[model samples]
Target chain A: MALDTKDVAKIAHLARLEVAESELAHYATDLSNILTLVEQMDAVDTTGVTPMAHPLHMSQRLRPDAVTEADQRDAFQTNAPATENGLYLVPKVIE
Target chain B: MHDQSIAELAEGLRARRFSSRELTQHFLERIERIDPTLNSYITVSTDVALAAADAADGRIAAGDAGPLTGIPLAHKDIFLTRGIRTSCASRMLDNFIAPFDATVVERLAGTGVVTLGKTNMDEFAMGSSNETSYYGPARNPWDTTRVPGGSSGGSAAAVAGGLCVAATGTDTGGSIRQPAALCGVTGIKPTYGRCSRWGMIAFASSLDQAGVLTRSAEDAALLLQAMAGFDQRDSTSAREMVPDYSAGLGDDLTGLRIGLPAEYFGEGLDAGVEASVRAALAELEKLGATIHDISLPNAPLSVPVYYVVAPAECSSNLARFDGVRYGHRCEAPKDLEDLYKRSRAEGFGDEVKRRIMVGTYALSAGYYDAYYLKAQQLRQLIAGDFRRAFEQVDVIMGPTTPATAFELGAKTDDPVAMYLNDIYTIATNLAGLPGLSVPVAPVNGLPVGLQMIGDTFAEGRLLNVAHRLQQATDWHRAAPADPA
Candidate 1:
């Protein structure tokens, strides 16, 4: 299960991160080492064991449908990188 | 004043010997003088601290003070502090001022605790050593050349250095306990859901838990009592009632069943660390506790399981940090994809990028079951080991780390070497059990920590055991020589 540079590049793209060409080899090697470490899990017999999602056994607690938070758009938007007319600004996706 | 415990400081405030403002100023001055070498604080809010101190004084003067009234503490930068910069020790959030307080911050503030500002941490709590921090690593207070175990390194160093009475820290995987051990302080990562996660930046939502680093177990109990409880805002917040942690400090450890896991003392454990841990167990035995040999067969796989699970969760959670909404943004993105990719690449550090990629790979279409699902199932086995051990023993005792603090840059080049530093402590996080690290003895002039693990919501029992140890030995009282 060795990870090559192509595999590293594909994963980086999936993660929405742009890795420099020079760093891809480094990442490939590092990711391979990590995979080797985790590959030990494959040896464990997990028959009939339910996958633990959350550490606590409780199910998600639901709240009543109501307006619980005050609108703070102006305060929240102050930290945005770009905004116009009460909306976040991103690059144009439309042709 | 800098060396006083939180309880002692609260007592002084009640007696009017000194106001909170005076106390805050004393610590601020110490930070100004001492932090240059330690690099423990990312932000020191002098104005905000003084203002909060003034408010605390008003409460004391009006005869309306709680146990933590007028005491000052540092936050681990991961917790949001309104109108103050919360960097999480990353360039991404370098300029991000939190719009609201984290539940831990709000609760402690309500108890009249003054803010001493945010401490440094590993970026997004990703690394074991503080070296991964965007702002340089926090140096160990005991020996400036070594690291204070992280991502709660700054909190550990601050308390150990006497710059603050206590500080807040979060442990996703031994972040609180490992650093506490290396710096020779007290730190506890309570059972998952013991503290609310709302507004505390998520690393791995399931594993991440907020806890405290302090000078003594009694101080940790006092602070944890204020921080733990249910919060509706956090979907995973436990609905259990919060107990009075300080009330159980006097409970005797007689007849206590302590489990010694043979797997923890196996290969890679430093001889010096092992000796100190054994000595600590002997002391507990003299206090009428019984030690039993136990085995957690799957314990060795904890680090691998953590790397897969934590990174997978981090990859999902960090997707929100695109260039559009907030945080570091790349300039002049030609397209939406460019905006996202470049902004993230430039904003995140190497370790963060590594994890994001690893997580994305684990959760990818073809490898999902082999990596992610198998890891989850193994997580259960690791947790099951703890469940079986707890049935026979009241608590588990071991070394907090395989070795004491290592020199900076020693293990940075190899990620696997760095990951093994937390091997003994990560299993507790995976099992969602309460774990604490109390300084036991100095090995080769560096401190070693004796770790105590308890069942879910058994924080008071763990604190009681740690409290008893601190009462009998003066290891927690040892401090570094003056920097000046």
Candidate 2:
């Protein structure tokens, strides 16, 4: 279950992180070590065990489709890296 | 005055022996003088603290004071504080000012508490030691060269150093208790959902819990009483009635059934730490408590399961920080793709990037069943172990950490080594039970915390058990001198 540098590169891409080419091998080693540790789970017999998503075994609490929040756009935009005309500005998505 | 208990300080304020303003000043002055060495605070809001202290003074004058009124404390930077920089110690939000206070912050403020400022923590609450903080690691007050275990390291260090009366900390895995153990303070992580996570930065949502670190369990109870409750804003917040956490402090421990999990005391547990925990158990026995051996067969697998589940949740939660609405953005990007990738890479640290990678891989197509689903199944096994153990015992007792605080950079290079730092404490989080740590004894003058794990929402009982130990021993009161 050792992840090679190529696997690490693909993971970095999938995760939307730009790992430097030089650091890919380093991350590969680290991730492989972590995966090795995770391989310990293989010893446990999880047959017929349901995958638990919540700690309290509770389902997601649903709320009414009502907007309970105030429009604090002006306040929130203060922390934005870039914004214009009440909308967040990122690099042009469409050519 | 700085070393006095919260009750003592509150009494002083009520009797006008000292004003809240004066108490705040004393702490501010101490932080100014001492924090340079400890690096405990990310932001020291002197003006805010003084103003709140004045307001507390007014409340006292009007006979409108509660238990924590006028007591000054710090929030781990992971909790949002409006108008103040809430850098979960990550470069991504290094400049991000929270637009609103976290629910815990608001609740404590409602109790007329004075805030000292935001304390430092592991960046995004991801590391076992404070080393991952963008600001810098908070030094252990007991030994300057050593680390204060994290991601709540700064809070523990601040309280241990007498820089603040107490501090708020979030525990995902062993964040609060591990640091408290290393720093010789009291800390508790109540049952998940017991405290609203509104505005508290999300780490592993299912695992993260807000708690307090204080000089003693009594102070922890006082602060926790102010901080715990439900908030509609937090959908996962519990609707359970908040109890008087301090009510059980003097309750007798007679006939208390304590479970000792042999898995926790096995190999890798330092002899000294085990000795100290055993000594604390003896003290409880003297108090009329009975200890029984119990088995949590699945407990050993907690660290592995936690690494998988926590990172998986983190990967999903952190997707919001993609150079978009807020947080760090990259330099002029050629296009949208470049913007996201570069901003994230530049914004996150090595450990954060490492986790995101592990998480992405786990949730990816081929590995999902083997890693993510398998981890979840094992998680239930781990939780089930706690459930059955609680049936036979009122509480489970063990050492909070396998060893005392290691030197900074000791485990920084080894990810697995750092992850194992939390092996004993991670199971409680996986089980979503209330767990608390009290200073049992110091091993080689470094602190050893005796952890008590109770059933869900049993925070009061945990605090009471911790409180009784503090009464019987002076270990919790042994504050570290100024670290050179």
Candidate 3:
């Protein structure tokens, strides 16, 4: 169950984090240790046990399709890193 | 005046002994003077606090005052405060001013409570020792070199250090109780959904719960009464009616069935902490309570289960912090993918990055059923253990932490060692039950906390037990020798 640098790199990529090459060794060791600690779950027999998503056994409460919030694009976008003409700006996706 | 209980402050205000403006100014000045050493506060809103205090004074004059009217307190930076920086002790939110108030903030403000400031916390409420804070670790008031248990460490330190009357804190996995134990204060994490989590920044949605830290359990009850309720904004907020937490404070413990969990007292418990907890139990026995041996067979798996479940939820919740909308952004990203990856890499800290990776791996294609699902199933086992134990006893009692506060950097290098610090308190979060920590005694001049776990929505009972303990002992009144 030990995580090597390659596995750490893959996980970091999936998580959308740009981990430096030098830090990969550190993360591999740390994540491996954490995985080892959590590996204790394998010892328990959870046969036929239901996987619980919430503690209260409650389902997601649904609301009507009506829009309850007012448009405050300017206020909400105040913290955005990049924005122009009431739209968030991102790098070009098209080739 | 700074060390007085919230109730005492309220009485003094009603008696016209001091104006709310004066009380607020006293705390503001104390923070300016004392917080440099403790690093407990992230922001001190002087003008906003004074204006609120002035309004409170007007309310008092008009005979519209409530129990908490004009009382000054601090909100943990995790809760959003409009027009103020809500850092959550992370560099990502360093410049992110919340556009609206958290439900907890709105509710407490409705009570005419004056907010002194926002307190520091572990980043995203992730760490057990406040060392992960981007601002800095909140020092334990009891011993400056020691850590105040986190991620509610700032709130605990502020209350214990007499910098504020009380403060709001959120518990995901023993965040509130563990810090309260180490800092010698009172804290309670009510049943999940007891308080609305609308604007309290999400960590582990299922495990995150908002509570309060105060010098005494009576003050905790007073603050919790204002902070707990249902809201339509939070879908998971319970529709249950909010009770008068302070009303039942005087209930005697005669015939109270207290369960001493065998798993909690078994091993890894420091002898000093165990002795203090046992001594606290003896005091409860003298108050006519009966202690019974109870077993929670799955309790030992709590720490492992939490690491899996909490990190998984955090990974999902934090995905919103990409470079596009808000939070920290990267410098000169070459493309869209670079924008996301570099921004996140630069924004998050080592522990946060480690958790994100761990969570991503756990939820990945080949491992979902093994790690994620297995953890969920084991979660139910832990909850079931609590359900069965509650059937036999009214409440479960144990030490809040295995030991007193450790030195600031003692376990920072080892992740597992830090995780085990919360071993005794995480099970209650996994079970989604209410828990309270009350200062019992000082071992080697460091405070120890006795934890009481109750069934779902039994916060009043937990507070009542803590209040009775405080009445029988002077531990809660023992302030730190050094306010610095």
Candidate 4:
């Protein structure tokens, strides 16, 4: 279960973080140690146990499907990095 | 006057000893003088605070005052405050001024409480210490060289330092209780959904809970009374009726069954801390309480399971901050993919990035069942241990932390060591039980916290027990002298 530098790099890439090449070795070591510690969960017998998702044993209430509010597009998107004509702008995907 | 407890301050304001404005200004001045060194506050809204204070004073003049009316309180920067910069101690939200107040903030504001400012915290509540804060680390007011335990460190430090009467804090794993334990203050994390999470910054949604940090358990009780209630807006907000926590503060613990977990008293516990917790337990025994030895067999696996579970949830919770609607975006992005990549890279801190990596890996396609599902299943086992113990005892007593506050950077390099810091506190969060940390003694001249944990929605009983302990000890009154 030892995590390697390449695995660390893959994790960083999946997490959308830019880990420096030099730092990958350190992260690999640190993360591997953490994973080792977490591997202690292997000993516990959770057979026939249904994973508890929420602490409370109640159901969530469902709401009506309705749009009751006005969109404050300008105000909401005021902090956007790139916006044009009441929409978020992104780079062209297709040629 | 500056060091008055929230109860005393409320009474003083009610009795005309001091106006709310005067109290607000006093704290404002203290923040001005001391916060520079402590770095506890990120935004001190003196103008807004004073205005709220003025309004509070008017309410008193008009004979309309409630429990926390006119009281000045700080908030962890994670909560969304209307028109104020609610940075969750990350460059990502550095300039993100929230347009709405968090349900907890809204509830506190409803009580006519004045806002002192937003406190510092670990970025997105990712770290145990406040070092991951983008602005800076919040210095422990007790010993400036040491850390104020985090990510609710600033709230704990400010209350301990007397910069504010009380403040709001959030506990995802052990954020509220752990910091309060280290800083020698009082904090409580109620049943997970007791307080609404509607506007609070999402950490681990299932694990995160909004709580209060203050100098005394009595103060925490009052704040909890205001904050706890059902809100339909937050999907997880409990439908249970909110009890008047302060009304039952004097309930006698004469026949109460207090459980002492043997696992909590075992190795890794500092001798000084063990002595303090034992003395606190002995004091409870003298108060006519019976102590029983209980076992939580799954307790040891809590830390490992929590790291995987919390990080997995955090990874998903933080996915929203990808250079989009609000928060920091990279200056130049060649493409949409580049925008998300560079924005997250530039915005998040190392600890946050590390957690995202851990979480992403745990929740990824191949590893989901082995890591994420396994952790969740283990969470139930840990919780069942508490349920069994509670069936035999009314409440559980233990040291809040295995040791008193350690020096800064002591475990910063070793994340596993840092995660172990919450061994005594994390299990309560996993079980969704109400937990309180009350200062019990001075171990090596540093405060050691005694943790009292009760079953779900039993905050009133929990506070009464902690209140009795505070009455029997002077540890909560100890404060640090001015730093050199």
Candidate 5:
């Protein structure tokens, strides 16, 4: 229940964020405080309640499979941090 | 002319009293002179707005002017604007621009409102105070050393400072109403899915509802009518009919049953704020409205549940900002994991990183049932409280915030303290109901907003009640002296 620096390190990795080793204790304290706050839910007796996923009770609407979007590679590509030959560039996963 | 309401301004345009170009120029001059101290605007498209104003003038000359024609206003940066930088006040999207417009922006433009560019907001709409914004905190117009309650702080300040006639704001948990309360403006967040979320940046999609901050309830009505409607693109958008919001403003509140929740007025509520809210209730009673004391027993758990649900959803939504496709990327990644980790760390602020980590931890292995699932179950009970309360009354009344706007950097070090600022307003969001804030009075020289919570799809009624109050009082007309 208590989140220490080790827990903070693990969470940072899972979240794909790099946290400096020295700052882990600070985050741990904050996250632990937040967790303590969230523990208030246990006070209520939610014996058979269903978790409300969305605000409304409506089911997701389904549409027939079709391509409604137009190709905007040029426009979309403009926002890419790194691109070459119409493809986004990232570090290669394969050696 | 700057103090005029949307309806009055529309009349002036129709009567040829002032051209849209002249109106736009006036606001531009004000923004130039006043915004340096207030820091309300992020991007101001001067040339584009002038050109749009000219086009609006042509529409007026040809007799095609709408209520919002040539009305220069600002959009919260959360809403996407085509070719305009729509930074969600985060460095991750500081240089990000979408090729299209958000549904709210598209719809508002369809009604002929000129854009004065985007206003600042709490980064990714996460923080209670706008201090988390990358552009720095927006000072309250009422008191320059204080904060304009956020994440719609800039919009609220813009409206209060008369930098713009009105502006768009998105409320996840009291973002619109809290700022409205602090800045002395009228703000309303309609029921979830009442406005399309297609172009609005996602921040807890289920709780985010597009709304407006304006000088008066009537002005809010005029803007909301244009913003609300169904859009096929947004899967959650409702099929309900958009009504004439302005038409119902003069409706009588003779038989209105306003409920005062006991939980809302308890400990932690400032004495000055409670007294101001009580005065507003007394005024409403004089108009034949009856007050019923009610109890939303589960309201206290709203902050806890929100931190869980919002962060959990944010983790999922923000995962798309990996270093690969768009947004900020690492300089030279050794590999994929390093690219993602370093890019996200470098791009995001401390609060953002903390939330993402918390969210990941909540939904992580073995903790999902304890954190995310439990929060959702508790969410049902909190929402149930509103449902039961609504069964007994037409609307619920309370303070918009526990206190008026606090000093800049006052609660910055204490996250929980900042989170509790929304205690009175978060339950409405959790219930997915429409809520509004009407400026009632100033407490300690800072504005206080009396919050009204109506049943789902009751925007018209909320606006009507707020409109009635404004007609009888000049509290909404209070503005700071020349934006400090």
Candidate 6:
């Protein structure tokens, strides 16, 4: 199925990318071409096929329930774009 | 001395022939002279590296040196390094100095390797070629006009150009092998879980495997032995025991059945590359190895399947980069949606945007089953082909890339054309198998990489075969005529 400008806009929104209205047509076309490639998957028969989460058939490895490394909030957030009071500060979520 | 392998360098360091500080300075001087033209490194931590080298010297003087002591190496920018700018070669993380070392970084630090600096890569490891990197493309050392194969292009270039002894590389769909092949260095991508992905910025987590790019297979063995191990922090880290990769370096390849996939030798493969790989296979035959022409029927479809699976995973992996978090944020946001949109648009590159869009489309409503799920199913078939072929042979042999390193901007405008460069190497990632790219010969002044693929956790065997090939040829040791 061909992706329209509206679909491209929606995907851009979902991805948090601000695609301009003028650029929508380009994304629509480029995304449609990529989708055409992805569309090849439809030809494969996957009935009764269990989706693989990992390549290895082993169970997830578990670790001891303990914090081995000390939380270095001051050290860790030293490079944050905006941090305050040892926490990453973001635009106020609530009005 | 500039072309010494990691093994040779380690031996020299242990024998007091040279101090780690002197070795680190030699590489620093090379980078200062050559890296401006090559653009192989994003950052070179000269002071920190010198300090680390001094510490390594202290260790050797005290007789506590490890196999990698005093050896200088580079890291793909995707791997986090404390107090270092780990940009992943994107403006999104341009100012993002990792607060802590990635598990791989910590592991290597444990082995006493001197980290010269961080190398450039495709932003978040999204592209087949390093052209997508925010820092600009890493030029191939062999032919400066061409690209060094990426997203590990910087690592491969450093080794090939003698900027560093060896460097860490992450492969998601041939990132390690492709560049290694093109740059005429030895690169290996261990099985998916063999190296902990923690702190190695995620890009198609299931497909991403951290490996080493070195001057020789023996150096790769030493690096892999140090990097491969279980990390409880990473849920996918293998709980299995880590093997002594060096011990298996001398393992015989005689009587080993090397499978030549008929599908890999078909149309689109350059005659020059085909001839070089075939010649390398013949050299192995002289070593008592048998070559069996086998078939991986589903191999051709790997490109499409990879585009779907990789993008779908990338779409999810990159979601964390919003205006709200630690990386890049929009200057000012009128609202939440504006924050998200403007931040991403401003932070990411065109290739990254294209992939995120493709990934969103595949995993979007009503298309998940048709595209994402179906692609996963096809990935299984592609993997099954490798398993069936492994039954008939001890290892698989093929060209690392369809052609040698293409010119800069050659395929940049055409995404599909760029994607085709990975056809030979993607199947290994899809199968979670270990693969190595060993330079065989020069074609059109560019080095051709012959890929060696082995079963899961078969890195030792893979390196052994690569080791044998290197011993028989000088291609692995061959450097560019003009190091500058």
Please give the clash total of every predicted structure, in order: 0, 0, 0, 0, 1, 0
lDDT of 2 by residue, B344-459 (tens): 99999999999999999999998899999999999999999998998999999999999999999999989999999999999999989999998878999999999999999999
Model 6 lDDT per residue over B1-484, tens place: 6788777788899899999999999999989999998999999999889999999999999999988988889999999999878999998998887878899999999878899999978888877668998889888988889999888999989888889988999999999999999999899999989999999999898899999999888988888888898887788888778788888878777899999999999999999999999999899998889999999988888888999889889999999988565778888788777887888898999989999889887888988887878878888888888888888899999999999888898988777778888999998999999999999988977899999999988898999888888888787777897554
Considering only chain B, report the TM-score of model 6: 0.99
Candidate 6, CAPRI quality class derived from DockQ: medium
Across B1-484, the per-residue lDDT of candidate 5 in tens digits comes to: 7899998999999899999999999999999999999999988989879988999999999999999999999999999999789889998898988899999999998888999978988998888778999999888998989999999999999999999999999999999999999999999999999999998999888799999999999999999999999999999999999999999999999989999999998999999999999999999998879999999999999999988988898898899889777788889899999999999998888888878887889999898998889888988999999999889999999999999899999998877788888888887888899999999889878899999999999999999999999998889988889854
Worst 10 residues of 2 chain B by lDDT: B475-484
Worst 10 residues of 3 chain A by lDDT: A51-60
In order, candidate lDDTs are 0.92, 0.93, 0.93, 0.88, 0.91, 0.88
DockQ of 1: 0.89
Cα RMSD for candidates in order = 0.8, 0.9, 0.9, 1.2, 0.9, 1.5
Residues B1-484, model 1: lDDT tens digits: 9788888888899999999999999999999999999999999999999999999999999999999988989999999999889988888999899899999999999998989989988999888779989999999988999999899999999999988899999999999999999999999999999999999999998899999999999999999999999998888889888888899998998999999999999988999999999999998998889999999999999999998999999999999899788899999999999999999999999999988888999999999988888889989999999999999999999999999999999999999889889999999999999999999889988989999999999999999999998888888999998576
Clashes of 4: 0
Residue pairs clashing, model 4 = none
Per-prediction DockQ? 0.89, 0.88, 0.89, 0.73, 0.84, 0.66
How many angstroms is residue B313 displaced in model 2 relative to the true structure, after the best TM-score fit? 0.3
Q: For candidate 1, give the lDDT of residue B326.
A: 86
List runs of model 5 lying over 4 Å from the truth: none
Model 5: DockQ score: 0.84
